[model samples]
Target: MSGTGGRTLLTVRGLAKRFGGLVAVDDVDFDLDDGEILGIIGPNGAGKTTTFNLIAGALRADAGSIRLRDAEIAGLPAHKVAARGILRTFQHNRPFKGMNVLENLLVGAHRRVRARPWAAALGLPSARREDAALAAAARETLAFVGLGDHAASDVSKLSFGQGRLLECARALMGEPAIILFDEPAAGLTSVEAERLGGVIRGIAARGIAVLLIEHDMRFLLPLAHRVVVLDRGAKIADGTPAAISREPAVIEAYLGRHAGAAA
Candidate 1:
């Protein structure tokens, strides 16, 4: 279903993946709309990360169709998929160790750089102008993710939660049509998770599609416009947060019997 007034931006059908004899993902299908936050939730080994990897081109799908609008992106390499405007953040922060926060963010904008290597090597006017512009945009993204003050700080100086926000800002610098988040709230404290939730909402408000795979139900349910539940690598429920909370199968499989009351 479309979110608010947004149109469909991503479509997945019969998506399947296997690791030897184990089925990691089994014929999953879903649609993501522009400006929507779609959460994929499941217990351990339920194919959440595998599905995420397939969509982001981090892993090849053994069978299925993954389309960004009308173009097939299922088998594309990671860089090619990123070039097509899909960016992602990992469960663990992976910032550039030697770079300052802003410099790290600038790396994410590499796809948008227009100057030729020769021009940049020679420090030509065009290259200088492009560098300045990208740097400015990177700063804006840093501020947007609440890391404005850390722009000049060493990446190692930031706390774990701050590092996660940095990962988010770096992805935003790519100006992605869709952003895949793998367990974003995994290592965050309650307050940190809440803050991150607000940042995610802000991202969706800008018309970027958000596909999140999170194990934290409390964080996922309230923030997602729609939730897709998986059990044993198969989708068992798909609906609004409220509806998902009350699903018998979902409750039994993952959410537990108290899910309705908790939600």
Candidate 2:
């Protein structure tokens, strides 16, 4: 198996979803190659978020299969899915306001999916060791995402761009093989977005796959290795950025989809 049949790190086959009489997502199939930066785009209400929700286990799929590195993961709980090396960020870069930035990141490092709660609560020696390891990893992850200076800062204190970086840092703390990013560059300034683009390339350099759902084609174009276009829950195009931008079907899909969305 090669080309479409081989080297895929993630796969969605026969993917579908339903809400009463509405089909939010309908039988979509796609593959994300290993370490690839896959950019996904669609107009408003095109089921892009629905697809992310389904793959991230935020919602149950009516029918289909989601595979990470060839392992089936459909119907699994969100945390369990994350344990299988899949981490996801939402369109809104919501950070826990109760915890400082570092503390919030440390929480994400507990990726084993099983730990002695009481031990952790009481700060047992084993738990202390785990905390230390996570704290160090969190620092490294923060620096990797260009938030090292803000490590001791509060989450409620971050700028929009900084918050997005923190979200990526938190996801990296889990040591995920792949991360699903939803509108990561949304609400960012031009300079901030460019910095984030550089950071994403660094992430790919670290050998983690990134599958992003973005509406800003101008920003996504330079970063994405491949682009996938969705229309009314179905994939309308899949190819390089140049090819995708030239596809008439894709242009039509975005015409009435999102007025302010850049192309």
Candidate 3:
């Protein structure tokens, strides 16, 4: 499933959100295809996070539409959005402090292990089987993100880079169709950032669409199939990564403004 060749899996059009008189997102539109890695970049206060919130249902849109596989989901709650196979990782990784890495991932897989209340309460065979399957999946995901050795370690004890990997593992436990990554490389050393980039590519190779909001241009430009640039609250450019780099409006509004760093 090539990024541009695949069928459209998500469509956002005229998406707008406002806080008082300040428009955070204004009439933005974009499409994400199956197996695509779409990057969203903009200067500070460009409404990148607000766009994510609207799509994830953490914030309701004041205007516009969001469709997931033809189903309207713009106004749904966060949990409802997750039920539709969309998951996200925050810029700040927030693993359960009291839980081990494996246990934290188990919480992510809870949605898939559908044991009846009675079955769980009675500690029936079905519940036991479900628990085992979830544990296996969690372990597999931990290994995939290169955190297998830390599966039994306390989450609070993990380094910042390890915590980010752990967050990705938890997201994978859900087996989501699309994962939204908000600055996955923030605060990482160069080596750690390189490792995170590989993990992201591995995820896309598995045919999951990725929508990344990141400020690291070096990391994002080479990885994304397409790049969308936002200035203020509106989309200024959307095209192939190469095309986005050469776009004059993008250069003038964003890239040129942050010439030496992320745009």
Candidate 4:
């Protein structure tokens, strides 16, 4: 997809990875444009998740350049990468199950705490100020997902759809400019999907870029400004949803699963 005024938000160049004898990702080159809803569509085992892993620092790339805002960040450690504001949600909604939804969101704001050791230990004025800020932010995030009243609920007790929104909220707590969403619509009912779509648009309205990797074209086409198709770890097409939806090569590669995969 074309970036915001030709500005590249993320650049992946010559990215290649191998696991034992399997070439999971093969010299893939792509870029995510600024503030665009870019959908990544692919079949099972097309290295979609692996690409996310490498970008988020869950795995080290054997070869490539990962540049965020034009600075090289390929080999950085996970925490360092996160500190750089590139955040991601898991394909699975991996919440901190033992904690309440509010607590989970608070954890995402750890990087923002400004407290001295003694002040925090004694619950001083500084600690109170920071805590108040976090509490307000957490509530706002929950409200964005239509769960402000359930902030105290245990994440383990949330319904499947609520849990997914909570997962997204926890990531949003970081206030990141870019977030990678792995199948945000998976397992959601029509109503839930509609809500999720609104949430995604809200995120974009805040000028945050979303790179969505989803299997449901029905859910994606309506929201995505552009789409990218992958097959066996290679990009076959990158264009607007209407154009990509009509490509025969994309249809053949993604067959029988995505909405137009069988076209």
Candidate 5:
């Protein structure tokens, strides 16, 4: 959907993906405007994750158009898609186990670092300057995601919730225009999930669009500006959270299986 100024930042039209004879996604269409949190929900085996893969360039679309601001990016490689300012966090955290929190974030800033291998090998002043700047930005992002104190800690030492925060911190280091979160609340306790909700709102306040795939309606409903429902590889409904709650098709597709969690 369009945002405050009627600007569409990301658009997916007639997006279709197939695996063998199975239609994983069928003619799905959606628009994510600047600074909006659009939640995607569905039952097991639904095309939620596949749709994310298509949009993030982890998978190619069999038929459709995926656009970022007017540039087509349907089949670009993941790195190229990331360079275009679309970054995604996984359903499970993927921190570099041997890397410290700060180091992991620096990896995410690779595209922004201007120093080439030769410059760094020779210890050029420009290389040193850029490295220092990237480090500073990483630290700032860690603080933004409530991981400031963990900058020096080993990734292996973080709890599940802290790891989730670290993943978000790394995404922030990339300075993406939009972030795709895949089941961000999956393994957290209620309190931790509540905290993540706050972090997501903080991210949106910075004018970044967020498209999240979450099964926790309790967490997703309040955090999302809008919700989209999918079932059997097709969209069933799209509306404000309240409207989605009462949508009969959504209820039949999702609530029958997830009503208790959403209760």
Candidate 6:
């Protein structure tokens, strides 16, 4: 279900990306509202990932405007975009190799740290206080994602599902205005995916926008407030899950003959 009475948080207009002669994202435009779950779905080579990369600032858009609260963020570097309150998770888990779960989460909060380098290096009281506060927040975030018990566990010791949850917790450490999830349900058992879906719903309930790209309709359709369907690098449909399910273009281009069964 869509969040009601929320303001628009992110806007993309005329967004386009090209690789040599291939148009990866063709003049795409979409709006993400605060506390909303917006899903992007398409078949392979449909430019979903490319669109995600552009929004996350991992890739520059060839032509378009990306606005975060009215500020143009189209060509900002990934770190800058992150600092501006846009964070993302990968399709695969990317835990910090040597860090424990809590420590890995702390790393995600680096952009939020306000202490000067010298202050931290000298162990000044302000830096120490900030460190303590951030650590506390990290713990809170881990608990939010159902990973509280694993705070001290080595990242390598985590199961695949736990690692994915860790990634979500880490992203939360940044206090993002929007979190971009790339194929979040991939490689998870049904139970794990169901749990992750609940966590995502909680995230939106807290007023953070969620942008999701996933191939798993069973996992995404019921979770998203709205969905954008892409075909051949262009959006073919954009609406509520039920509405999208009935879109003729979407069915023909991406869902195929068994669209009804899939829906």
Task: Supply every candidate's count of residue pairs whose N, Cα or C atoms clash at under 3 angstroms.
Answer: 0, 0, 0, 0, 0, 0
Q: Write out the backbone clash pairs for model 5.
A: none
Instruction: Please give, for residues 158-239, the per-residue lDDT of candidate 4 as tens digits.
Output: 8888888887787788878689998988889999998889888888777788899988888988898888788888788888
List, residue by residue over 1-263, the lDDT tens digit for candidate 2: 11222268888998999988988898988888766888889887788889999988999999999988768999999989988888987678878778888988876667742448898899788878877777787888888889989888888998989888888887887788889998888889999999899888888778788888887777898899888888888889888888888888887777344543532
The better candidate by TM-score, 4 or 6, is: 6
For model 4 the local lDDT of residue 169 reads 89
* TM-score, cand. 1: 0.95
Writing each residue's lDDT as its tens digit, candidate 6 over 151-190 gives 9999999999999999899888888999999999999999
**Model 6 regions lying over 4 Å from their true place:** 1-3, 257-263
Decoy 6 TM-score against native: 0.95
TM for candidate 3 is 0.95
Clashes of 1: 0
Candidate 2 overall Cα lDDT vs. reference?
0.83
Error of 4 at 51 (Å): 0.5
Global lDDT of each model? Answer: 0.90, 0.83, 0.90, 0.84, 0.89, 0.90
Model 5 TM-score? 0.95
User: Cα miss at 30, model 6 (Å)?
Assistant: 0.9
lDDT of 5 by residue, 1-263 (tens): 55334368999999999999999999999999888899999998889999999999999999999999999999899989999899998878888879899999887777778788899999999999999999989989889888899999998999999999998888888889999999999989999999889999999888899999998888999899888898988998988899998988888889776876555
